[model samples]
Target: MTPNPTNAPARLGVQLQPQHANYTQIRDAVLRMEDLGVDVVFNWDHFFPLSGDREGLHFEAWTMLGAWAEQTERVEFGTLVNCNSYRNADLQADMARTLDHISAKGGDTGRFIFGTGSGWFERDYDEYGYEFGTVGSRLDDLAEALPRVKARWAKLNPAPTRGIPIMIGGKGEQKTLRLVAEHADIWHSFVAPGDLQHKLDVLARWGEKVGRDVSGITISNELSRGSLDDGHADALYAAGVRLFTLGLSGPHYDDTPVRHWLAWRDRKNREAGVGAAA
Candidate 1:
């Protein structure tokens, strides 16, 4: 289910890409991010390194998410965007349900948000022995898979405490945006500020045509130093975006950008007269 936007003021999240960092460092960074008031944390699903040294130590995403579920107390967690091609729909649903149970630990279970995308990284497909079909075919697979995922979630023995939120990430207008309108609780994209507004306009149009209210769907965009400073966040926020994610890469896991964004997030919430839930 889509979360109530009015419940929290806008929230800030960080993605700790597990490409270069060791398990200890990655775990420690998540702890620190939670302490520093990040509302959500995530890691990408990939077996090999995405940057820096190609052969750098890397970890599987869902396994790391299980570890994270046990480690953090206040922060919500999930894959920044799990590739749909990597796992079967039922398996992904089961994994998400298990993570939800692990994170909730006898409490409320709305903590896990399953952020996924139609796979794009070709190298992952080649290395993992999955068929790397055309983009259209992959999107078709994703379209078919989403319903099966939802069905499996319902059929699981211990159902998700609360329906786990489904976040669909991509900017493809025809297929991706249509799927977002039909199935996503959250929609993530990386378009520029100007283009974001236009794309969102299109998304809303699609939602209206499908009789869905796009207003309930959270929109997320990646945060970087220059991009955030270029009025991208402000523009997107004005365009109905609420959840903002900053990607942190490497062995260092520099906190400077994260700190700056947190400050910015707080200020924005204050200016808007809303207290964000931690």
Candidate 2:
């Protein structure tokens, strides 16, 4: 019999955009998501909303994470991509370790994925008093921060329940992919079906340059609007993406589309017949 690939099944994640809603609403939404059998739940790291109103109600990422760490019983969760510019690397590492422990309730690899990226939103930087550095500078900062993050994890009082998986989100081939090859356990992007192979090729080259086997790194693709077309998912699946994320806004995130995505996840898992590690 053929061995089932370790990453055979595709998984679904919900990006609970923490905007335009109260904490209770967000909390209830997460419970509802868990009931739907979503594999993961995510919230972005930003001080303000990325869409709709600029002054919409939004909660902080890491703080809310602590609550999820305690509240969630089954679903894995984390920042869709935490802004590396906002916090110290060591502190970030410590916080992740603590959350990892909190999430380890009966006994499981603590369901916390540390998804992060270089800061991009100008408003988050400006209003939050963080420096709005150039793109190059931010990427450089992330490259430097990752090592410190790992180092801190090593020296923590109580280590993480399991080595928290580090996921880096971005598509820049030069610095970003190189960093992914060096440090990330997963690489996230919005590459279309047509461009997916090329990006994977670039990532493979980066792995060779860094002397790391990146075939193990998970590929996370966005649930884009245009990607909603028929056969769109098939093309992406054929391209080797296994972790899909759906972005939803608060005040009232539409649940109809979410149900569709969850059903797709179930069908994909049933067909694959193995847990999708990616």
Q: Which model scores highest in lDDT?
A: 2
RMSD, every candidate, angstroms: 2.4, 2.9
Whole-model Cα lDDT of every candidate shown, in order? 0.84, 0.86
- Tell me how candidate 2 scores on lDDT: 0.86
lDDT tens per residue, model 2, 1-278: 11112355788888999999999999999999888888889999999988889888988999999999899899999999999999999999999999899999887768899999998999999898999989999999999999999999999988888989999999999999899889988788888989988888888888888888887787888886523543777677778888888888988877777788777777777777766433
> Taking the tens digit of each residue's C-alpha lDDT, what string does model 1 give over 11-50?
8889998978788899899999999999899899888888
Which residue pairs collide in model 1, if any?
Answer: none
Off by over 4 Å in 2: 1-7, 226-230, 275-278
lDDT of 1 at 40: 93
Q: Give the TM-score of candidate 2.
A: 0.94
lDDT of 1: 0.84
TM-score per model over all chains? 0.94, 0.94
Score candidate 1 by TM-score against the native.
0.94
